[model samples]
Target: MVKQEKVKVKPLPATIIPPTSWVKYFKEWHGLKFPVITCRPLGRLGNLMGEYATMYSLKRHYNVSVVMNSEFKSRIKHIFLNTSLPDIPASAGPFQLQDWTPVQNIGSLYNYAPIELAAAGLLGPKKFIMKEYAFEMQMFHQFREELKKEFTFAPNYTNKVNEFLSNIMKNRSSQLPDPVFVGFHIRRTDYKKFVKNKFGGHLPGTSYFTRALTHYRTKYPDAAVFVVASDDLQYARAELQQYQDVYFSQGFSAGQDMALLSSCNHSIITLGSFGFWTAYLAGGEVVYADVTTKHDYRFSRKSFEKFGLDYFIPLSVD
Candidate 1:
C-alpha cells in the first residue's frame, strides 16, 4: 500500500495586526500536530535573503523540516550554491493548501519561538507559511557560518567575481602597495523617501562617501580602492570622480556584484537592505553614513545589531 501525503486546503486572509496585536504572534500553540514551516518570499533579492535566512535559522536551530515554495526558489536558488531546502509549488494564487497556516509579517517582522516551544513540537499547526518581509537578523548571526556556506556564490558568479577582483588589483599602480578593496554600496532611487518615512533616515550625499572613504584611506592609505556599485552609477561617478583610486563596477547582476564586494577587504554602506547584506557577507570593518537610523525601531533593530560594536561612522564625519 502507498502512503498518502496529507494536505489541508483553505484561503487564509492577509494578516496585518496593529502594534496592539503583536501579543498574538507569540501566543501559545494548542495544535495537536508538530508544525512544518515554509516561508513565502516577498520583495527583491535583499528582502528574499532576509526571509530565507530567518526560516533557515529556524530549520537549523529547531531541528524541524522547513520547506520553500517554488517561487522562492525561482527567485533565489540560482544565485547560491546551496539553496538545498526542499520546495513545493504555490502556483495557484492566494490559496492555502493542506495544514498550512498563513504568517503575515510587516516590514522586519519576526515570529518569535522559544526552545521550550520547540520541544516535541514547533509552536503551531501542521504547517506554517512564514510569509514575507521577515528580517530576523538577530539569530541569523548564530547560524552565520552555515548561512555563508549555503549562500556562497554559484560557480559562474564566483568566476566573474574573481576576474573582476583580479583586474582591479592588477591594473592598480605600484605606487599603491598592499592593495585593499573597499566595497561601496551607494543606495539611491526610492530610498530618499522610503528611509525618511520608515526609519527617519536621510539619503547620504557625496561627502558621506568621501568621509567613509577617508576613514579607509587613513587606515589603508593609497592601497585602498573605493569600488562602488550603485543604482545611479552616473551620479556616483559625477559625485566622487575627484577622489583618487576610485573604481566603479558596472553591468553585473546583483549576485555578481555582491560576490565581488564580499571578496573585498571592507565595506561602506549608505542604507537599504541590499547594502546591509553586502556588508554582512563581506565580514570586515564597516563604515556607514552616521545618518543610519540611530535608535532602532521595534522590529528593525536586528538589522542594526548584526553589525556589532565596531563601526566607524561618527556624527562629526557626516
Candidate 2:
C-alpha cells in the first residue's frame, strides 16, 4: 500500500493588514486623498451584525475597514464565507482613534442622522476609528440586498445545511404529505442571566412554544417537522419532546446552526440577534417571543421593524 500523505491545515494569519498600508490603500481606492474609517467590532455573532451593519452603511459613503477583535476572527470567517469586506490588516500601522459616537441610541429612535454624521466626519483629512456597537438595523436596511450578497454561508456549512434539510424531509415523508420544516431557536445559556436580572420579563416558557407550535400545526396540518436549534441541546430535546415529529440538530458549530435555521420554511425565535438574523434570512413565517417587557439593552423593537416583517407573530410568555 502506498503511504498516505497528510494534508496540513494552515493557521489564520496573525494580521490581515500590513503596517501603514491602510492609509496608502484608501488614497488609491478613492482616486484622491481621504481619511480611513476603521471599525472595531466587539462581542459575539449577534452583536457583530450591528458592527457589520454600521460598516455596510459607512462603506456607501466613506472608505471603511474592519479591525476585528482577535477572538472573533474565526467566527467571522465561518459566518461570512467567500465575502469581501475591506478589513484592516492586523499588521497595518496604528489607527488614529476618534471620539466614540453613540449611534445605537440615535438609530434606535429611527433617526438617520448618525449615518450622515459619520460620513461627514470622514470628509476631513484626519483618519478616525469608530468605537460603538452601532447595532442599528436601519443602517443596513437600505443596502440589505447588497448585504445579503456579502453574508452568504461558506460551502462546507452550506452543504451541511442542505444535508440537514434533506434528512428532515426524508424522515417526515412517511408521516405527512409535504412536510413543512419549522426551525426553533431556544436561546438559553447566558440568556438565563438576562431572565434572572429581570432584563426581559421572564424567559419564554414551554407554554409559549407549545402555543406557537399549535398555531403552525393548525395552519399547516398537512405536515410539520420542528427542527430545534439551541445552545442547550439536551434541555431543548427534553422540553420539546412532547410534540410529535420533532427533531434536534446534532452537534454543529453556531454558523452551521444558523445556516440550518435559515433554511427552514418557518421560524420560532426567542430573544437575540442570532435568532433575528436566522428568521430574517429564512424570509418565512416567524413566531418570536414577546419580551418587550424586559428592557434588555440589546433587544430593540425598531430593529424588527427595519426588517420589514410586520406579520411576525409575537407570542407573549407573561
Candidate 3:
C-alpha cells in the first residue's frame, strides 16, 4: 500500500495582545486560520524583535502556532521590569502542529496588502515588493520612501489614530497659527536593556524641546498645543512645565505609543524607536537633539531629512 500524504490545514497568524497592524495580513490571507496563538503583553522591544516578530514571521510564512503558557505570563508580569533580555528564552523551534485544537471558520474581512507590508518589514530593500505583489503592493515603494522620511515611522499607524488627531483638532479652536505645529518626545526608557536589544540603543538627551516650544510661543503667538509623549511620565512632566500649553498623554503599554503618537499633527523625537515611531506616525516636520559622539544618542538630521522632516529649532541641554 502507498503511504498517505498529510492533510495541510491552513493555520492562522497568531493574535498579539495589544494587537498591531501585523494582524492586517492575517485577515487578508484568507486561507490561513484565524489567530492560532495569543501573545498578550508583547510590550517590550525584546519581545517585539525576538519572540513577537519571530513568531509572527513563522506564522505568516510557515503556519506555526505558539502558545506561551498562562503560568508563564503570570510569573513574568511580576518580574518584567527587572528582567533582562537573556532572561527570556527563545521558544522551541518549529512549533508542534498537534497542539492546535480545531475550530470552525469565520467570515473574511476586506484584504489590503499595502497595509500588511508596513508591519511585515516588507518595505525594506531585502524584503517583499509591491511590483511583484501588485494589488497588495500598491504604495509599497512610494510608502517605503515616505517611511524613510521623518514622519514615516511605519506609515500604517495613522490609519486608525483619529482619536488623538480629533483631540488636537478640537483643541485648535482659536485662530490658527502661522507655521503648523510641533511635537515633543522625551524618551526616558532608551537605555534599559529591553530597548537596546532591538533598536541598537538609546540616544542622549539635548534640551532642544524646551527651546523650540519657547521660540514657537514667541514667534507664533497663536501656535496650538505642543503634544508631548514620554516613556517616563514623571520625568517629562517636570521638564515640560515651562511650556504652559503643552499636553501630555498618559503612558501606554510599550508598542502602543506609536498608535497614539501617529494621531498628532507634528512631533519632536528623541533618539529611540519609540520616538521614531511617533514621528513616523505624525508624518510632519520634526526637531531632533544634536547628538554628540560621546553621548551616542542616534537622531540625525540626515535620517529625518530624507523624508522631508527637519528640525525647526535646536534645543540646549544647559
Candidate 4:
C-alpha cells in the first residue's frame, strides 16, 4: 500500500449554509474540520467566503474532524465552494427585500437564483451602512483572489472526488456515457414564472453550443462529444446528431455525476447549479453561452470570471 501523508487543516471558525452532510464528509473522507456557521439561509455571504478562504488558503493549517449529520451512514459528502459576482449587481439597485415582493417584480424573486441579493442583503444595517453592494463586491474580489491562490495550488476538489474521477476515467461506473461524450445541464428548477408561461429558456446559449461543437468537430473528428445534463438527454442527442461520438449520461447520483464530469476533457455548462458543479469538477476547458436573458448574464459572467476565463469559451455575438 502506498503510504499517504495526512493533511493538516486549520480549525474553521464555522461552516456556512453548506449542504447538510458537508462537514461530516470532510471529516471522514478528507479529515478536515468544518464547524457549522448558523447564518440565515440567504445571508452571510462575506462570512462564508472568509471562512472557506482562510481554511483552504493554507496548507497544513490543522487536522479537522466533524460528525456526520446525514440519514445514510455510507452517504458521501459533496462540498461546493462558490464566490462569484453577477453582471448587473442586484443588491446595488433599489430592490431591497423589504421593498420588493415576490409576485411580479420577478427580478428580486430569490436572491441566489438570478443573483445572491438576499445573501448580500443579509449584511445588516449597521455593518452595511455605507453601501451593501460595494461591500459585497469587494468581499468577492478579495475572496476570489484568495480562492485563486488556493484552488490553483491545492486540491480544491476532495480526495474521494479524485478517486471518483479515476473510476470514471476507467469507465467502471453506473452512469454510462454515450458516444459523443457531451456535457450539458438543465436549469429549470427555478424560473417558476417562466415555467408557468413556458417563456423561460436556457439563457439563449444553445446556439453558442452548436457553434462550439462545430468547431470541435473540425479539429477532432473522431472524439465523441460527451454531455452531462440535468434534464433528459434525448432532446440534446436528437439535436446534436451529426457528431461522431455524441453521448449523454442518465440521471445518477451526485457523486456519480461528479465523477463522470471530472473525467471529461471538454464540456459545456448551463447557468445553474448542476452545470456549475459539473464544469468545476471537470477541471477541463469549458464553453459557456453568452446569455442575454434577464438575470442570466450574472451566472454567465460570474462562472467564467469566478472559475477563470481560460477554462471557458463564451458564446459568440453576431
lDDT of each: 0.65, 0.63, 0.43, 0.38
RMSD of 2: 12.8
Q: What would the TM-scores of all predictions be? A: 0.77, 0.76, 0.45, 0.46
lDDT tens digits by residue: candidate 4, 1-318: 111222333322222233332222222112222321111111132223332333232211222221212211112223333322111122334323333222111333222221122222222211111111111221233344445433221233445445544444466333544334445554444443443344243444356556766655665555445554445456555565565344455445444455456456667765544465456445556666555454433345543454334556665522
lDDT of 2 at 276: 75
Please report the candidate that would top lDDT against the real structure: 1
Best by TM-score: 1
Local lDDT at 74 for model 4: 18
Q: Give the Cα error of residue 77 in candidate 1, in Å.
A: 1.7
In the range 165-250, model 2's lDDT, one tens digit per residue, is 78767766464688888889888888778566755455687877787788788878868778889888988988988766688888
Ranking by lDDT: 1, 2, 3, 4
Count steric clashes of candidate 1: 3
Model 1 C-alpha lDDT per residue in residues 70-117, reported as the tens digit of each score: 667788778987876766434323435454666554333344433214
Q: Cα deviation in Å at residue 254, candidate 3?
A: 3.4
Cα lDDT for residue 207, candidate 2: 76
lDDT of 3 by residue, 142-161 (tens): 33333333122233344334
